[model samples]
Target: MPFIKLEGGKIDKEKKERLISEFTRIASETLGIPEEAFVVLIKENEMDNWGTGGKVLSKILAERGNK
Candidate 1:
């Protein structure tokens, strides 16, 4: 059995769903385990609480036109 924990800033429901599905597919194939034997956890944080290169994720996304 495998437990997957994904940590990131806020994201839409559609993207989250896709991520979970993709992760399950890859993990199941790579580990040769059934998809039902895996557990996936998505942990979201506030923009201010997540950062990269000394800058907050919100600011980076805003500067990039919110992607």
Candidate 2:
């Protein structure tokens, strides 16, 4: 089985479903693997727990006036 792992900030259930379906569809077409043979894993983290450029994600988003 093929595994797809996505790590990012939290998202709504609808978005997660979309991500899984889209990923499965595209990967299945490209790799010639059945969608049922693939696994999609979404790992969500709190904004304060992840960071870039040494700054917490929550702070970065705050700076950008996004949440």
Best by TM-score: 2
- Per-prediction RMSD in angstroms? 2.1, 0.9
Clashes of each: 0, 0
Per-residue alpha-carbon lDDT of candidate 1 for residues 1-67, written as tens digits (9 for 90 to 100): 7999899878799999999999999999999999999899999999888788999988998899984
Clashing pairs in 2: none
How close to the true structure is residue 16 of candidate 1, measured as C-alpha lDDT? 93
> Which residue runs of candidate 2 sit more than 4 Å off their true CA positions?
none
Candidate 1: residue 63 lDDT (0-100) = 93
Give the Å shift of residue 7 in candidate 1: 0.7
| lDDT on C-alpha atoms for all candidate structures | 0.91, 0.96
